[model samples]
Target: MDVRTLEYFVAAVECGGFTKAAARLHVTQPTLSEAIRRLERECDAPLFHRVGRGVVLSEAGAVLLTYARRVLKDMEDARQSMIALRGFQGGRVTVSAPPALSIEPLARIVGNFRRAYPDVTVVMLPTEDGALAAAAVANAASEVGLTDRPVSADLRAHPIGSNEIVVVLPPGNALSGKGPVSLEQLAGVPFISSAVGTRARNLLDESKERGIALQTAVETPHREAVIPLILEGVGAAFLPWTVSREAESRGAVVLPLLPRVAYDLLIVHRDQPLTAAAEAFVATALGSSPVGGD
Candidate 1:
């Protein structure tokens, strides 16, 4: 049906009934109900069924709602496309990456992009699950994702670089002068591990699966915070070598994990050739700015 009907239908689902939706839409209850009824008639299925005191989506309604969201989004995309063609002052691009990586590089990259384009907008997102690939594939985000893994087989891959996991030792630990500690070496020590749900913990688990037993004494969401405790010699923590590099440069001795565990930082795009903007970003990240000499 019309966009108005879809909008009303979506509102009904959100507001739980025609009356509430009518109030929210600043329309009469009868008008909202008629619109939804028209929509249901056109689709040949009831979109909602009445419960005791509330309304809920029927089986058919539930299925349509999912598609309704996608349709509305595509409408938005169409609008944005038209705006871009008119030489709009700005366009938004969604980018996702882990918190640790975004904190440092995003600012510089965004600044550079703005300086060059002056009109493009960036929506920066920090992902938690460590699966940037899935987010990109779903198109909830842009084709480009910064993560340890490729977004999907259907997407392309480019390495931004790699980071090593280092052991953060507690202050004044007797383990000084010990070169290259293995996961096996720290088997008995009380260690803080990355929290269970994050990508870091998954990496640790996979490492464990590969015969490396991690002795985690604490589990934290921000593993970077574990650095200070290590300097105090409280316990050992593992973090990206880039993280450890900053520490080492500042007098923290970041020993390499034995067997040399390294995580690659990747710039992944949809398996298809990237969009012009997404391609530009990948180039900028790879230190190849458009104007020559990044």
Candidate 2:
């Protein structure tokens, strides 16, 4: 049977009635009815059972529905594959990243990819944390992602680089004059830190295990707020070197932490095959400079 007739049959079965399906397909009821009639004749059995106002699929129709939907989905997949084979000239790739990461290497890589594939659209999906970013790729909401934390076993992850986590001090603070601040020097100091359960927060927690008890002045979920809080003289905080560099011009002093703590940066995606656009983006990211090193 022709794909159009099969589409009409499936639509009729889904819409529950010929008239409703006709309205949905934007075809006249007679035309839809004729198509289903032809479909039934070709199959040598009735496809639907008539009820008072609607219709239900017959036993034969029930069996055909399964294969019919699969066939249609396969056809669509073939079409997409053809388009992807065209070097993603007019395709779209959805990516997910933490709000903080979307600004840096991720944004730079996305920009570079766009320049190369001007016709392809790159959509950024927002995620709050590394876990959420990994979930987006795992669940197929995003094809690829950048995250600070390790993802589950199902995904492929690559260590792009590491960034030195530094102590951000307010302008003219006593610690600002110190070349490198140590955990012991920071002990009991009022600190502005990331919210609990974050990578940055976990770093602070790990330091506590080494006998550094930081007095948290305020905890914020927004990474953007850390520099501003430090500039306002609220408290000191540990931040990635890339981020702290920007805060330097805003009157914040960035000093390396004494223990030389650093966070590893990663690029993640599902183990499944990537589309052309996703492959290109990942390639660019792999070639880009690592965090703090750039």
Candidate 3:
């Protein structure tokens, strides 16, 4: 019914109990309980189900939670915008990105943005892949997103740059000194790949569909482990050229793919207006040099 009531409801769900939520909000348990009860009456349904001294979101609660968080985020954005009228002194920009992009452009973009707006806070929300990154922006969980593929129609994509995909091999492998490797040469060679649905994995799947035989020796959810596994001689992998260079310094042999695979780096956001802080962050990203070209 009110911002304070919605905050209390969200806190109760996050803290998992009224007692904890009351403590978090610095309000008495009775007051929090009355606020929740009032909200339930307003909604005409129970929001949470009591179970074993804990709380779980009921069907109505689940639905309300999404809208409640979005409302709270919008309110916070509005407050920050008012603060921004005082010459960009303070605000926050939340970005959702996959691990690979987080390494290059996101890191560089945050550094550049901070040099200009030192008082602004930069929050990084790590998603598994581009789709989730776009989802975060669409749902108001993040102000901006860095993705490697096209997003849905509800968002706008700004082409920031591109990352060249390279092949990584263990130290001293037969292909160590080989020139650019082709898809046919990589066929039958085991690959250390990310889990399916990631852009890199999707490229591999497309290659398979094109009749190129590729073998995945290890498929992992952790992108950080891919390089370590390759260094351990587990298998070769496909990594962004920026990351592959780092792996090369650590003794992994990096080779350019013959056909030169590249993923376009896009900064995505809602089609609607963005807060000043978010706009500045996007501008910084767009101004950065192309990931591999530099």
lDDT of 3 by residue, 1-294 (tens): 999999999999989999999999999999999999999999999999999888999999999988998898889889888978998888899999988878888999999999998999999999888889998888788889999878999899999877888888898878888888898888888888788887567767887898998888998988889989999999988878877877899998888888888768899998877889998999998888877733
Off by over 4 Å in 3: 16-20, 51-53, 204-213
lDDT of 2 by residue, 134-180 (tens): 88777565778988887899899988777677888889887766787
Candidate 1 vs candidate 3, lDDT winner = 3
TM-score of each prediction? 0.68, 0.70, 0.88
Q: How does model 1 fare in lDDT?
A: 0.66
Ranking by TM-score: 3, 2, 1
- TM-score winner: 3
Alpha-carbon local distance difference test for all models: 0.66, 0.80, 0.88
- Best-to-worst order by lDDT is 3, 2, 1
lDDT of 3: 0.88
Query: Model 3, 255: alpha-carbon shift in Å?
Result: 2.1
How far in Å is the alpha carbon of 25 misplaced in model 2? 15
Candidate 2 is scored at a TM of 0.70
**For candidate 3, which ten residues in a row score worst on lDDT?**
285-294
Q: Write the per-residue lDDT of candidate 1 for residues 184-255, one digit (tens) a residue.
A: 776677766777765456656776787766666667776667777667655676666555555565556557
